[model samples]
Target: MRTYLEVSGGGVMRKQPYVCGLDAAVDVIDGKWKVLIIWALNHRRCRFGELRRLVPGVSEKVLAQQLRELEADGIVHRESYDVVPPKVEYSLTELGDELNTALGPLGAWGKRRMAVLEEAGQD
Candidate 1:
């Protein structure tokens, strides 16, 4: 018989085992747009237009949807100010900062891999 150890936050054991044995973290940030949005917000807070400009190739509707989802997940915060033009801004929450920290190494790995792919004419 094989025994599996389920390790979670702070090395604590979970009472209920995962269905597929995969972490739920990935599910929260799943999809191409979500990561891109998080990456853009990782640097600083941005207005709607600024975010749309920073992430190239994303449609307005899709971007809005991604932002809403991130906001609902508590990883991103959306603030609105009563102004002439209805000012709105988006920034990473505390959870998002932690997530960003974890993703930094992955981003670095991707950068290195991309450089290699470019040299090999794959990118």
Candidate 2:
């Protein structure tokens, strides 16, 4: 078993035995419902309960977990207001917006692949 991972350009061997930046990036965004949550916040900011309703079938625990993770990863921003009924909202950060732009082509490719598969199945 290989103990070290190598980076291509720098001839650098990571002795820590961990994933590189790209792998970490993929890991952060990867989940059954993560993209959905990201996409929901793509257009506008939303509150916690609103996000829960926006993303169907996600339990409160799961949604909260995912949001926390996303926030930690710098993909989402959370703001709280001190009011009688406290208000909080979430929106995509600058990095999040860049990621959303990057994901668009990938989503389009997946859509095209699915359509092709469906057409093939109909034959």
lDDT of 1 by residue, 16-122 (tens): 43355235577567778888889889859999999999999899999987887777767899999999979999999999988888888889999999999999999
The whole-model C-alpha lDDT of candidate 1 against the native structure comes to 0.80
The positional error of residue 75 in candidate 2, measured at the CA in angstroms, is 0.7
For model 2, residues 35-58, the per-residue Cα lDDT tens digits are 888988996999999988889999
| Candidate of highest lDDT | 1
Question: Tell me, what's the RMSD of every candidate?
Answer: 7.2, 7.0
TM-score of each: 0.79, 0.77
The residue pairs found clashing in candidate 2 are none
Colliding pairs, model 1 = none
lDDT of 2: 0.80
